[model samples]
Target: MVSAWVVTKVAYVVISIAAGLIFFYVTSPLVKSEKKQPLEESVSLLINFVLYIWVGKILLNIDVFITDPLAILAYPSDSDAFYAATLLLFGNVIYKVKWKGLNIGTIMSSLAPVFLGSAFVYEFIEVVMNDSTLAWGHLGLLFLLLLFFLIFHERQSSVATAGGIFTAWSLGQLILTFYLPYTTLYGYMMTRWFLVLVFILSMTNLIQNKRLRS
Candidate 1:
């Protein structure tokens, strides 16, 4: 039998895979566009910005370094803020995306509720069950992280990035919710890895799509 922790981790991994593929398919159209900037450059810009989001949050969370709330929020917010950035990328920058795939649609559809709902449910569990020892602000931070995805970059990659961001933030939310004894940074690590992976997938899809189109 799979433990709840294992189950949650597996679900996140599955979400990551789904998000990566969906974004790849959705961004296919933009990848082949007649744009002046190199496709890699465009994707690289997105990736770099996304990386900047977490660099502070990750470092400050270290046991060796104590951080202010604003500083703490910076990383968490960046992780959540990434979704909003994706919206701008897809909406303002990229003009096209193949939104025909069922996988993409399904992934996009399930993402919002999953992350947001997890926030509420986490609180509910903390209140209802006696197992929770986490502080309210910590839990509240999770809520903020989960809801941070309100408006995303909204480009061809939005479908995948939205889901991917949601997944990553959701994992962060889940980990932060738990009353862990030590090493609270695992959630952040997991979130960063997923975001990086999804970004890479988006870029790869663009390159492949561009090549095939040419």
Candidate 2:
């Protein structure tokens, strides 16, 4: 049987994702016209992303899964699973862009709001439900990013805006890690070096987008 804690966590995830979808639709008008994806497409992508994460979890715990597939539901996923999911997601995106002729920029633009919105909701839940004070810092950071995106989204290119938000978020999380007792996102054990790498990648993407526009 699935544990109550697992059920609660899944409920939180569902709530967060719903919040993200609502946020995306509410803010759709502000997104760059050229980068806006259809609602169906965005939903499909999000579903696929969630599936990838589940697959990652299963793969990371293959031993347990092989022994008793039903038992897997009780196991919690960790940073390693997250990394695996991310890599798989990245590969899937690349494949879509290259062979399926999907617009990478549009995908990124469509995903940005949902990602931030979900993150904000998740952190808020952590603070309220779990009494995690550290989550407040992450909540504050996401709130500012969302506000900034709303304020300047109409004026900025979607890729640039997404890149900027990610860069800022990564840097903010990195700084928070120094003073906080644990990692921000899902309380996963993300190392400072990983955050730095994300920061660098986001900054690079932002710069490249600017140069392309110029």
Best by TM-score: 2
Across residues 28-64, which tens digit of lDDT does each residue of candidate 2 receive? 7654553245555668777776777779989988898
| Model 1 TM-score, all chains together | 0.30
Question: Candidate 2 — what's its lDDT?
Answer: 0.81
lDDT of 1 by residue, 1-214 (tens): 2345545543543444344334443433334453223333334443544454444434535553354544454323333444444444444333333543223333343333333444445444444453544435445654564445444434434444444454555455445444444212212322444445555654555455446546
Q: In model 1, which regions exceed 4 Å deviation?
A: 1-101, 135-138, 151-161, 167-214
- Native-to-model Cα distance after best TM-score fit, residue 4 in candidate 1, in Å: 16
